[model samples]
Target: MQPSLAELQRALAARILAEEGSDLDDWICVPSEADSAARVAVYVQGYPARIREALRETFPAVAQILGDGSFAAFADRYAKDVPADLQNLNLVGAALPAYLESDRVSGDLPFLPALAELEWAVDRCFHAELLPPFAASACSGWSLDEWARARVGFQPGLALVCAPWPLRELRETYRCERSEIDVDLVDRHDQVLVYRRGFDVVVESIEAAEAEAVASLQCGDALGEVAAKLAGSGAEPAAVAGYFGRWASLGLVVSCEACPLP
Candidate 1:
């Protein structure tokens, strides 16, 4: 009449994740003086604590902006709302940015969602693999037509986050290692690029045209299509070329695929 090991595991999981009454108490043993409910409570409390700690580490700026008390409260609510990804605490904060978009905290600080997004991007880039520097000489023989027809690939660590807020300044102000300073939170379109350069992650503001071009490329658009879109947006003829030039110099570019003209 005893529950199987698999059944005990299922019940224990339900107990930890939520307030689901389970007969797991009947399975786990403890000191005669201690209770099974106390053992279950340890896991119930520890799991959320571990998740909050991971989120704080990954989103130090957000945590600083929210302050210790508010961040803790929001993290607990998030733990309840969003199921942990792959049961890994390290990946728990992956949903924080989207979760903040609708949370009450965002109502007070309108930039919270974008800021969290940038932080997440930073974390991802730091963890991404560093690819070998791409050789630009590979395209020396390509004509303009060939270049336009090509689909460009970028480094694995590249990520673009666009927001209508001065995101870079805000991120630096509360960044983990910095003194508090006044930062103007002017509402303006900010296109931020995050990529791993050498051994460190670089987070910098980029021009709108560049962000647009990179975004198109990230979407798998051909270089000519990206150029046409940029032209429609009033970007100069040389603007698309400039983007590629800069990207190549920075090692952001990885490869280019162009078919020979018939």
Candidate 2:
């Protein structure tokens, strides 16, 4: 009896990825004159090659830091350890940030996980669909009372990364084609906002107070509640307006809703 399509696919995957080339050939393509095992070897090499290319594309900064040979080694190890079940290569590096954190692949580079996280976020934001920008004029008619209870929504793929290292600077260090890297590994608290601007994904460092309000809004808190929290934290709650204005200008905001009454 012939193996089903699903069975053949599973066998092929195991043969290529796990090298579990047992009776896989028995269920594969109808025995042709050509060497079928050679065909399988093509996939065996191609799968890892494709995944490595995708990782390089998604994490160029990481590749630059790790160097070609080292990065390829790490990429291969990651691909092998973590199954790439998805057909889309773009999504393959989605878990790389977490993997870096869990694997602790580099002891010298303590910031690798955070850097990978920022790069992954940039990749995600670039691919994310941008919705219609929120209109600040929509709140023109609302009274102060109504404005306080308004719940804000940010654009899709907006990501916040707070780290003890200057992640943006580190990423920029490798962003350009430089022959040599003069890295200043300064340890300081850095908060950055990642979002799509037109077709480009941009990363900008933000203030601590602004970061607080953004974090609150991201948590689904009302603007009034965020303001109160900010005030309690000794931050100027009114500064939220400036932050909102900047976000609106950058097209980060997508929606705003008022608290519903029973």
What TM-score quantifies how close candidate 1 is to the native fold?
0.90
Candidate 2 lDDT by residue in tens digits, 1-262:
8778888778877877775555686666745688887877898889889999999999988888888888888998899998877889989998898888866466878888999999999998898999999988888898777878888999888999988888888788676664576667776678889998889888999888888899999999988888899999999888877887888898899998788753
Please provide, for model 1 over 161-188, each residue's C-alpha lDDT reduced to its tens digit, 9 standing for 90 to 100: 9988888887875655434645577667
Lowest lDDT sum, 10 consecutive residues, model 2, at: 173-182
Off by over 4 Å in 2: 1-8, 24-39, 176-179
Where does model 1 exceed 4 Å of error?
35-38, 176-182, 259-262
